[model samples]
Target: MVSKTDDKKAAPAAAAATAKPEEKKKVVSTIEEDDEFEDFPSADKEVIGWDAVEAAEKELNAWKDSWEDDDNETDFAVLLAAEKKKVSSAMKM
Candidate 1:
């Protein structure tokens, strides 16, 4: 029943109806190889002064002394309150 002209017109319509829509791919840009180390600074080559070293040692010694004093105290209530406060703060975070 179809003529050549009618078949030609219907051919395109039929093809279009059966064809699936193309999915668009997302493009993501990556950091260039040369810029990988650009965010970090160069290694420090300078020597630390003796005064700064002595001060750090003193601070660490003070912390050790405080820890020893705490060990002698054996206060369960204070330890429990500190733990509860730490847990509450962590939960909030």
Candidate 2:
């Protein structure tokens, strides 16, 4: 037979079973809590390879001038279409 003290101890366990379970705290994501922002370097520093870049720029300008001279003589739309067809045919091979 169960003792009176054992019955009293058992009463709390039954009461605990009948009580509603505690709700868990909801977790918030860092992305939701903080504003989206990115820190990028400011373009204030003087570039080191300015001379080489300037030389390359001069070369590119001369090339572009020559290309423009050639383009003035040709029908650019026809040239582009022909080049595109050639490229597509080459890709197929």
Best by lDDT: 2
RMSD list, candidates in order: 28.6, 27.3
TM-score of 1: 0.21
Candidate 2 lDDT by residue in tens digits, 1-93: 333545555555455435523311111244443453432222212333366465456443434434445443368877887899999999999
TM-score of each: 0.21, 0.21
In model 1, the runs with Cα more than 4 Å from the true position are: 1-74
Candidate 1 lDDT by residue in tens digits, 1-93: 333544545655555435522211111234354344432211211333465565466443434434435443358867887899999999999
- Ten-residue stretch with the least lDDT total in model 2: 20-29
lDDT of each: 0.47, 0.48
